[model samples]
Target: MNLLDKFDAVTVEADFRITPEDKAFCEAHQAAYDAAIQSFHELAFFWEDMENTQKELLGSKEDTYLSSRDGPEISQRRINAHLEWLHRAVISNIVYHFNSTYHVSVRDDYVANNLLPQMPDLRIYENKEAREAYHKKLREAKIRYEDVFDQMLLLLDGRSFTEQAFHELAEKCHKAAWNLYQNKANYERKKALISFNGYFCSLHHYSWQDEWTLEDKTQDILRGVAHYETGSFDVYPLGFSELLGYQRSPNNEHEFSTCKKVKGLKMFKNGRVDIRFTSETYAAEFATRYLGLVC
Candidate 1:
């Protein structure tokens, strides 16, 4: 049968079973979950100690954090300071994971920045009546600053040290003690999958198997399911090759032509899968392909 025809023969339905190996691999990445939780805690800690005092203006109620609204340079200073503290801790976290996967640990920092900027200083203010509007702007500034951090935590909540990072490092470290090994794609997929929460299945799992699976320390198996499976779904477990618009000839079965990984795939620490698409069109096509969606 033709390759596409074979894909046609396979259809995705409810209650799919992911393989044990994949399941175990997912479970083995508990460090990632711990990293997420620790990262969240660290973020909250920083917000309470750092932003509340400096940005939030917590000492006096009427004199809230924005009472002395500094321009862009001041705000950026605060952000850089906050991120500096964040960098120190996350660096250690990444090192801890790499240490566990290998016999030795490195004291070096692998600074990973997940937070983005929200520039609130650019809002226009016109006159004395603008003083009334100024409060609103300040409030917006507080929210905007907090939002960048809040979402940054959310991003951290979705990530850990289990992706192509290892794929690349594994090859370099193969000759080193406590050797590392995984295919380039598999390593990349693992990292990408960690970015996901229970909201979506790992592309790592979806790419190689029908589902994401996990095993407990006792060897009990669990199949990862979508967090929100009730509503109509837009994408299905089609071969990533087709889903991502990757093109390659069959003769080079292992050959894939692109480095673009569809962003925002989801997963959970307990080892479950979820599906959320960045756009409806991609979702629709995925559903049509592997989900047996009628034309």
Candidate 2:
């Protein structure tokens, strides 16, 4: 017989003794598989929607000439909306799979590799209170799936994998995603550090304070400026300043400058700071402390 006919003949001649319990088990497995597929379809739809929103936001910038003054504000609103949608997409994926009986490993892998890494700083621009609420939710989700995630991670780490190719692939994908995230984080940190010198120069020109104090209000202002410059809300600007040896005065108040005077331009002019000091004594101090440069 031909291949198709031989397969059919074999099926017809099969004397498989199927019991009622075996049939029930097969049906249950099929049902679970169907549910898993459906969950994936829903995730696909969420991703498509997210991509469309991002595209629309990018397209909105095409009319830059018309809305030159309001362009940034409009772009920011769209960006916030996109971030909110992304947060919802992640939460939806986790919730859907968490409720599923099958493919628990997939859910665990996603949470451990993707969601947990981004927790506490998921790019959501909510207020401190709102961010805390989301953090609580994330913590609960992690607790729920952490055991399964650990089990799967251990299983995927085995040296011999004859039938675990799929698990291996999942591990590789997770690692790649994590690496991409780390690279992005490194890029942001570098950019933020580079911009700090410029921001310090600008601060000298403000006439707001003769000497910068490390107060809560100062920290908040620095945070806002850093956010404006780098589009990063994750890094603490004050922490960067501390790393540069810019400590608060002993009395926790602003004080006059103590560094020895250089021959060139004064760091501050007309009650404002000069930008050129980026290469002067201040820059030397910053490099020595922040960049670990001996000079």
Which number leads on lDDT? 2
Tens digit per residue, CA lDDT, model 2, 12-113: 222323346534544454455445445544554565665567668777445333235545333333433443344334334433442232222333345444
Clashing pairs in 2: 204-273, 205-273
Stretches of model 2 off by over 4 angstroms after superposition: 1-14, 59-295
Query: How well does each candidate superpose onto the true structure, as a TM-score?
Result: 0.19, 0.17
Query: Model 1: residues >4 Å from true position, as ranges?
Result: 1-15, 53-295
Residue 229, model 1: lDDT of: 22
lDDT of 1 by residue, 1-295 (tens): 4222323243333222333643454344434544544554565466557545764554444444532545333333454354334433444444454445432334433122223222234444345465445443322221122222233224322322232222223222221111124211111113212122222222233454443322121010000111012111222232332323223222211211221222233334354433334445544433333222212
- lDDT, candidate 2, equals 0.34
Error of 2 at 28 (Å): 1.2
Model 1 residue 94 lDDT score? 40
**Which 10-residue window of candidate 2 scores lowest in summed lDDT?**
184-193
